[model samples]
Target chain A: MEKDHKPSSTEKPVLQKVAKLFLYTFLIVIAVVQVLPLVWLFLFSLKNNQEVFNLPPLALPQDPQWGNYARVWTEGNIGQYFFNSVYITASAVILTVIFASFVTFAITRMKWKLSSLVLGMFMVGLMIPVHSTLIPLFNFFLNVNLMDHPLAIILTYTAFNMPITIMILLGFYYTLPRDIEEAAIMDGCSVHRLFFQITLPMTAPVVATTAIINMIYNWNEYVFVNTFISSDKFKTLTVGIQNFIGQYQTDWGAIGATLMISILPILIAFFILSNRIVEGITAGSIKG
Target chain B: MNKVMSDKKVIALYVLPAFLLLMLLVYIPIVLTGYYGLMKWDGIGSMEFIGLENYRNLIVDSAFWRSARHSLLLAIFSVISLIGYLLVSLVLSGRIKGADLFRKVYLIPMLLSSVAIAQLWMRIYHPTNGVMNRLLTSIGIEQPPLWLADTNIVLYSIFIPIIWQYAGFYILIYYAALRNVPNELVESARIDGASPWQIGYKIKLPLIAGVIKVTIVLAVVGSLKYFDLIWVMTQGGPNGASEVIASYMYKQAFTTYNFGYGSAVGFFLLILCLIITYIIRKLTATKEEVQY
Candidate 1:
C-alpha cells in the first residue's frame, strides 16, 4: 500500500490537511444551513413588512422592532396561547411521566402474569400512526362531549405519547437494581410506597429525560390540538400560532414574532438540557 | 418480595390507567378506523353500513392513489438520503474537530415545531423575495423558478426541508453507532494494509448494519406518514402534486367531511405503515438477531 502510494510523507500530510479542511468546511456549511434560517427568522421578526420585503434575508433592521413581540403578545391571543401551552404541556408531561413510570415499574419490577402481553400492547401502540386514529378520536371525543376541550387535547397527548415515554422509562427501569426493591419490600413497604418512595425517586434521571421528551412532543404537537380543540381558548401555541399567522398573513414581522414566540420555549429548554434531549431522542428511536 | 410483586390488585392499579388510555385512545381508535371504513357517515350523521364501499372507492380513487404514490416517493427519497446521512456520520465519527458541536448544531431545526419550520421554509421559497431565487438571480441566472407553486417541483421543495429537519437526527444516530464500532477491528484492518476507504467500507459499515436497517424502517415509515410540514406548507396543493396520504386523509375528513372515505384512507395508511414496518424488520432481521 505504501509503495502504491509512494508520495512524499510531507506531501501526504499536506494532502491530508487539505482534505481535513474540506471536511470541516463541509460540516460547517451544513451547520450554517441548519442555523441560518432560524437566524433569518429572528432577523425578519424584528423588521416590518417593507423592511422584510426590501431588505436582504440576512440583513439587520434599521431599527429593530422589539415591538413586534409586544404587539403580537398584546393584540393577538398569543398570551393566552402561551399560558395554555405552558399549563397543558406541564400537565401532560407530569401525567405522562408519572403514568409511564407506574406502568414501567409494574412491567419491570412486578411479577405479574400478563406483564409481557400488556407490555407488548403498549409497545405496539408506538407504531400506530396518529393519523389513523384521528377521525375516530375526533368522533369519540365529540360523542363523549370532550371535543373542543383542553382535557381532550391533554388526554390525547398523554395517550399517544405513552408508548414512547414508557419505552424510554423501561430501559432505565430494567437497569435498576432489584436489591433496593427487595430491601424496601422486606421492610414491609407497600407497593405504592415502594414505587412512589424508592423506585420513582431512583428513576428520577430517566424520568426527567422522558419528561423532557414528552414535553417537546406535547409542546410541538399540532394535529391533535388542531383537530380536537377548535376554540381559541383551548388551543396551545402550536395551533394558536396557525391562527395568529392566518390573521396576520400580511404582517411579516408579526408572523415572525409569533413563530419565534411559539418555538422559544423549546429552544430555551434545548440550550439548558440538550444532553438529555439528545439522549432521550437517541434512546427512544434506536431502541424502537 | 414475590408476594408483593405478584399482587394482582397492585399490578392492575399500576398499569390500568396508562393501559386503558392506550386502549381507548390509540388501540380502540385504530380498530374503529377500520370499522368506520365500512360505514357511510359524515362525521355528524348516523353511520349507515356500506360494507367496504369506501375501501373500494379508495382503490379506484386516483387522487388517493396519487397521494400514495407521492408518499412512496417521499419514502424512497428518505431512504436514499440515508446514504448521505451515513456518509456525513462516517466523516463526523472520525477524528474530526468540533463533531459534538456540529451534531448539535445540525439538530437545531429538529427541535422547532413543524409549523415554524414549514412557515419558515415557505418564506425561504417565496417566488421573488425568497433566498433561493435571490441567490439564483444574483448568480446571473434568469427567471428563477417558483418553488412551492410549481407542480413539478413542489414535492422536491418540501423534501429539502424535510431532509434538513431530520438530517441531524439520522446523523446523530449513525454517528453513535459508528463510534461504537470496535476500534481494534479498524486497527487490525489498518495493520493488514487496508486503505482508509476499505476500512470504513468493509469494517465500520458492517458493524453498524443493524442501526442502518432500523433507520431505513424509520425513515420510510416516517416519510410515508409525514403530515405537519406538508399540510402547513403546501396543504397538498399546486394541483395536488405533493399530496401524501395523511394530508389527503385529513382534507377528506376534516375539510370535506367525508368521514367514511377518510377513514378508509386512514385505515389504508395504518395498514401500509404496519405492513412496511413488519416487512422491513423481517427482511432486515439478521440470523444472529434471531438466535438471540
Candidate 2:
C-alpha cells in the first residue's frame, strides 16, 4: 500500500469535479433545510392566524407585530420561568462542576482502587435511562417531601448530569502532567492549596467548556423537570412552553409566541459566550 | 501528625463523597427499578409480590411491542440518517470555505431546547400554513401530505428535527477523523488516479472505523432514550404510532399510574443497554486499539 506518488491510472478529472460539485450541493441544501425552521418560527411568531395561514405564507411578517412577543412573555409567566431556568441551570452547573472536578482530581492524581470503582458507579448512571428509575427517584424525593420544588428538579438534574461531566473532565485531567503536583508537595503545598494554585488555573478551558455544556443540558432539560415540577410555581421555560401548549391547544399564535420567548435566554447566553461554548465542547469531545 | 497524606489509600477517602452521591442517586435507582419490576405496586400502594407477571405482560403487550419496535426503527433510521449526513458532511468538510459556516448553522439547533425546537418544527409542519406545504404549493404541487398528521409520515417528520439537531455532532466527529487522515494518503490516491469516493472508501473510511464504531454505539443509545423532541412533537400520537420504550414507560408511570410496570420497562431498558454494551465491547476487544 505504501507506494510512490503515482496517479491512479483509472481516475478522471471530470468525475472528480462531478463528485465535489455533488457533495457541495448536497451540503448546501441541507444547511438551508436546517436553518429553515428557525426562520419559519420567527415568521409565525409575528403573524396573526389569518396571515399565518394566508396563501404562500409570508416569509417576512407584513406588519411585524412585536406585541406578540410582549404578550408571550407577560401572559405566559415566561419571565419568571426564565428566571427560574437560569437560576437552576447555573447552580446545577456550578455544583456539578465542583463535585466532578474533585472526583477527577482525586482519581487522576491519587492512585487507589476506589478511584476506578467510584468512576464505574458514575458510568452505571450513564447507561440507566431516567424513565426506568424515575418512579423510585420520585418516591425517594416524595419521601423526603421534595416534589413540586425547584430544589428537587435541580438535585435530580445534577445527579443525572454528573456522569457525563466527570467523563469529559477525566479526559482533560488525564492529559495533564503530574510533575507540577509532585513538585507542589516538595514545596509544602497542601491538597487544597495545590488544587487551587497549581491544578485549578490550568484547568480553565475545560471548566469553562463543561460549564457551557452542562448549562445547555440543564437549561433545556424537560423530562425530570416536567415530572417533578407539576406546579405553576416551579416551571422552567421549556416546561412553561409545554404547559402553555396544554392550556392553549390549537392556539398557534400564542404557541409560536411562547416558543420564541423560550429561546431568547439561550440565544443571549450562547451569543454572548459563543466563543467559549464552541471551543470548550470541541476540545472536550476531540480529546475524548 | 500534620504531614503529607501521600498514602495511596487516601485517594479512596477523597473519592468516597462523590462515589456515595452517585450510588444514592444512580446505582440505587437502577437497583430499585429491578426490585420494583417484580412487584404490583401502583407507585403509591403497598408492594405486592408478583414475580414474572410484569415480564409476562411485557411479552404479550402490543403497546410494549409497538414501543420496542419504534425504538428499533429509531435506532436504524438514526444510524442511517447519520451516515447520509456524515457522507455529505465529509465531502464538504474541507476543500470548501463554507464548511465551517455550514457547520455553525447546522449546530445552532443543538443549542436550542427540544421543546422549543418541537414547537418551531410543529409550526413548520402545520397542515395548512406550514412552510413545507406552502413551498410545495408554490411549485404547483397540490395538497402536499400532512407531515405530523399522517400516521405513516409522523414518525419520519419527528426524525427530521432529530437528524438536524444531531447531524452536526457526527459532522464534527467525522471532520476530526478526516483531519487525522494523512494528506499524503489522499494526495497519493489522487495522484494514482483514484476518485474521491474511491480514496474515501479505500483509505479514509477504513482508517476512521474506530470513530464510526463509537458513533454507532452512541446512535444506538440515543435512539433508545430519545424522548424530548418526539414527545414534544407528536407525543407518540395519532394512536401511539411513534411511542418508544422510554415514552411507554413514562405513560405507564405517569398517565396510567402503573409504577411497577413502569419499573419493569426500566429494567428491560437497562438489560438492553447492557446487552448492546457487551456486544460492542466484544466486537472491539479482538481488534487493535487504533489511537487516531
Candidate 3:
C-alpha cells in the first residue's frame, strides 16, 4: 500500500520525460545551426567546382582535391602572409601584454598622485571607436614614413588593445595579496626585480588569458592592416585572404581552402584553451 | 611603505610608455579628427578651411541619413534577439547534461575572424550553388529570394550571420549570470509549488536584470559601429542596402578621398557613441542602483 502511495508516480515521470526530450531537441537544433555552415565549408574545401554544385551539400567528394590547399599556399602569397601574421601577432601580443602589465602594476601596486587619472584615460580609451582615429592615424603613419610598414601595424595593435588587456589584468592584480610586496621590500628588492621575479610570475595565469585574447584580436585584425599596409609582403592573412578570394572568384575549392587556412590557428587554440578563452572574453567584456 | 612604493622615477618608468602610446594613438587622434573636420583636404593634399560646411552638408546628406537608419534598424534587431538569447541561457542553466560542450560549440564562429566568416557566408548565399538555395530547392520550392542582391531583404539577410556570430557571447553572459542565482532561492520557490516558468520569469529574470542591461548596451553600440563583416560580404552593395556608419566613413576617407567629410562623419560617430553610452547608462540605472 505504501509503495503504491509514492509521490514519484508513473504519470508525472512520463510527462517530465517527454518535456526533457523536447528541451534537448530544441538545444541540439540550435547547436546544429551554429555549426552547419562551417561543416559545409570544410566539406567543399576538398571538392572541385563540379562536385560542389552537382552533389548534395553534405556529400563527400569522390576524389578529394588536396592540391587546392597546396596551390593556394604556394601561388597566392599566402606563405608570406602566414608568417607576417605570425610574427606580427606574436610581437603585438608580447608588447601589449608587457606594456599593459607595467601600467596595471603601477596603477594598482605603486603609489602615485596621478595613478587614478592615468587609469581613467585607459578605461575611457575603451569607448573610442577605432574608426574615429583611423584618418589621423593614416596621416600620422604616412608622415612618419611608417605607412606600409609592419611596425606601424604592430604598434597600433599594441596601443589599441592595451586598455582591455590592462582591464583584465587589473582585476587579477587587485585580488593579489599585499604580503608578497611587503616581504619583497623588506628583503631589499628593487621595484624592477620585485615586478619581474615576483609579481609577473604570480600573475602568469591571467597573463596567459590576456595573451590568448590579444593573439586572437591581432591575428584576425583587418582594418588597420588594410588601411596602413599596402604591400602584399606585409599583409596579414585576414587582408591577404580578401585579395586572394577576389582573384579566385570562380575557384570555390581554393577559396574554401584559403578561408580554412586563415581560421585553422584560431580553431586549434580554442581546442586547447577554450575555458581560458571563454573566461577571458567574459572578464573583458562583461566588466564594461 | 610610502617611501618604498612612491618612487617617482619607478612610477614614471612603468606608466609613461603605455600612457604616451595611448595618448598618441588613441586620444590625440580623436581630438585631431574633430579638428580635421573643419578643413577641406584630400587625403594627399593641403587643407582648405571649410568651417561648418561639411557638418552643414551632413545635416542634409540623404546617403548619410540612410546609412544611419540602417544602423538604427540593426540596433533594434540586435536588442530584440537578446530575448531569444536570454531564453536559451535560461534553458541551459537548468539541470542539463552537456551544457558546457554545447556552449563551446556555439562559440566556434565567434573564434574565427570576421573575414573568414564573411567569405564563408558569401558562398553559403551563392544564389545558385549555395547551401541555402540547394536546401530550399530540394524541399520543392520553385523560387527562393536572392539574399544579398535584393536590397529589401539584404539588410535582414546580413542580420542573420551577425546574430549567429554573437549568440554564444550573449548566451554565455546570461548563462553565467543565471548560474550565480542562489540555488536555495530556486529550491524554496520550487517547493512552494511555483512552476518552472514562474521561477524563470519572476525569480531568475529579475536577479539577472543588471547583466541584461549591460548586454543591451553592448549589442546596441556594437551594431551601430559594425563594419568588418559587412564590408567583406556586400561592400554596402546592391545600392548601399547594408551600409553602417563605420563603413560609410571608410568609403568617404579612403575610397572617395573626402577626408574632411569623412572626418565629420568620424567625429559624429565618436560623439554619438559616447552620448549613447551615457544615455543608456542613465536610463538603465534602477532606484536600487542609486542607493549605492
Candidate 4:
C-alpha cells in the first residue's frame, strides 16, 4: 500500500491541510451564527428605537440607553417577576432534588419488591407530554381551590422535573461503592441516617448537577406558569414578560431589555456551571 | 444490611411522596384527560356526557388535521436536521481544536427559554427592521419576504428558529456519542488505508447508531409537542398556518373554552406520541448494540 501511494504522499499532506482548514472554518462559522444573534440582541437592547431603525443592525448603541433596563426593571413588575422566578425556581429545585434523591435512594439502595415498578413509573413519566396533563391539572387545581397559587406552580414544576432529576441521580447512585454504606448499616446506622449522612454526601457532585438542571428547567418553564397562575403577583418571568412585552410591543429597546432580564440568570448560571450543565444534560438524555 | 435495606416502612416512606406526586400530577391527569374527552363541559361548568362525540368530531376536524400535518412536517424537518448536526459533530470530533468552545457556543440558545427565543426571533423576523430582511435588502433584493407572516412560508420560517434553538443540543449529543467511538478502531481503520470519510461513515456512524435512533425519537416527539416558540411567536397565526398539534389544542381548550374537544385533541396527542415512540423504538431496535 505504501509503495502504491508513495508518489502522492506529499500531495496528501497538502490535501489534508486544506481539508482541516475547511473544517475549522465551518465550525467557526456555526459558532458565529450561534453567538451573533445574541450580540445583536444586546446591541439593540441599548439603542433607542430611532437608532435601532436607522443604524446598521450590528452597530453599537450611540448613547447606551441604560434607562431602558431601568424603566423595564421599575416601571413594570419585572422586579417582582424576577423575585418570583428566583424563589419559585429555588423552591422547585430543592423539592425536586430532595424528592428525587429520596426516591432514587429507596429504589437503588434499599431492597424492595416493587422497586423496579416504581422506577419504571418515574422513567415513563419523562415521556408524558405536559400538554396532556394541562387541562386536568387546571381543573384539579381549581377544584381544590389551589388555582392561581404559587404552590400550584411549584408543585407542578416539582412533579414534571422528577423524572429527569431522578435519572441524573440514578447513575451516580448505582456507581456509589457499597462498602461504606454496608459498614454504616452494620454499625446500626438507622436507614434515614445512612441515607442522609453516608449516601447524600457521597452524591453531592451529582446532586449539584441535578440541582442545576432542575433550576434551569424550573426557571425556563412557561406552560405551567402561564396556565396555572392567573394573577400578576404569582407570575414567573416567562409568563410575566408576555404581558409586559404586550404593553411595550413597539418599544424595541424596552422589549430587548425585558428579554435580557428574563434570560440573564440562566446565562450567568450557564457560564458558571457549564461543565455540570453539559454533564447533566448528556447524562439525562443519553440514558433515555 | 439485608434487614435494614428491606425495611418496607422505610421504603414506603422514602418513595411515597414522589410516587404520589407522579400519580396525582402525571398519571391521574392523563387518565382524566382521556375521560374528559368523553364529556361535554366547559372548563368551569357542569359536564354532560357526550360519549365519543368529541373524538368523532376530531376525526373530521380540518383545522386539527392541518395542525397535525404541520407538526408532522416539523418532525420530518427535525429528523433531517439531525443529519446536519451529526455531520458537524463528526467534524468537531475529528481532533479539532476549540471543539469544546464551539459546542458551548452552539448550546447557548438551548439554555434560553423558548419564550425569550420566540420574542427575539420575532424581532429578528420583523418585516422591515429585522436583520434577516436587512441582509436581504442589502444584497439587492427588491422585497424581502415577511418571515412570520404569509401563510405559505410561516411554518417553515418558524422552523428556522426551532433549528437554531436546538442545533447545539443535538450537536452536543452527537459529539459526545462520536467521541465515545473507541480511538483504537479509528486508528486501525486509518492504518488499514481507510479515508476519513470512510472511517466516519463505516465505523463511527454504525457505532453511534443507537444514539442516532434515540435522537430521532426525541426530535420527532419533541416536534410533535412543540408549543412555546410557536405559541409566543405566531400563536398559530396568519390564519393558523404555523399551527402545530399542541398549539391547536391550546387554542381550542384555552382560547375557545372548548374543554371537551380540547381534551380530545390532548388525548390524541398523548396517544400519538406514545405510538410513534413505540414504533420508532421497534423500527430502530437492533439485534444488539455495538459495544466498545
List the candidates' TM-scores in order. 0.97, 0.92, 0.97, 0.98
The sequence of per-residue lDDT tens digits that candidate 3 reaches over residues B1-292 is 6787899999999998999999999999999999999999998989999899999999999999999999889999999999999999999988889999888888888888999999888898889999998889999997988999999999998999999999999988888888889999998887787778899999999888778878898998898888999999998878988888999999999999999999999999999989988999899876563110
- Candidates sorted by lDDT, best first: 4, 3, 1, 2
Clashing pairs in 1: none
- Candidate with maximal DockQ: 4
Per-residue lDDT for B52-91 in model 1, tens only?
8899899899999999999999999999999999999989
- C-alpha lDDT (0 to 100) for residue B63 of candidate 3: 91
Clashing pairs in 4: none
Q: Please tell me how candidate 1 rates in CAPRI terms.
A: medium
Candidate 1 lDDT, A189-222, residue by residue in tens: 9999998889989998999999898999889999
DockQ of each: 0.74, 0.55, 0.73, 0.80
Candidate 4 residue spans exceeding 4 A from truth: A1-8, B290-292
Better of 1 and 2 by TM-score: 1
Q: Please tell me the TM-score of chain B in candidate 1 relative to the true structure's chain B.
A: 0.97
Better of 2 and 3 by DockQ: 3
Candidate 3: misplaced stretches above 4 Å? A1-10, B289-292
Query: Is 1 or 4 the stronger prediction by DockQ?
Result: 4
- Candidate 2 CAPRI level: medium
Whole-model lDDT values for every prediction? 0.90, 0.79, 0.91, 0.93
Considering only chain B, report the TM-score of each candidate against the true chain B: 0.97, 0.92, 0.97, 0.98
**Which 10 residues in a row give candidate 1 chain A its minimum summed lDDT?**
A1-10
Classified by CAPRI criteria, candidate 3 counts as medium
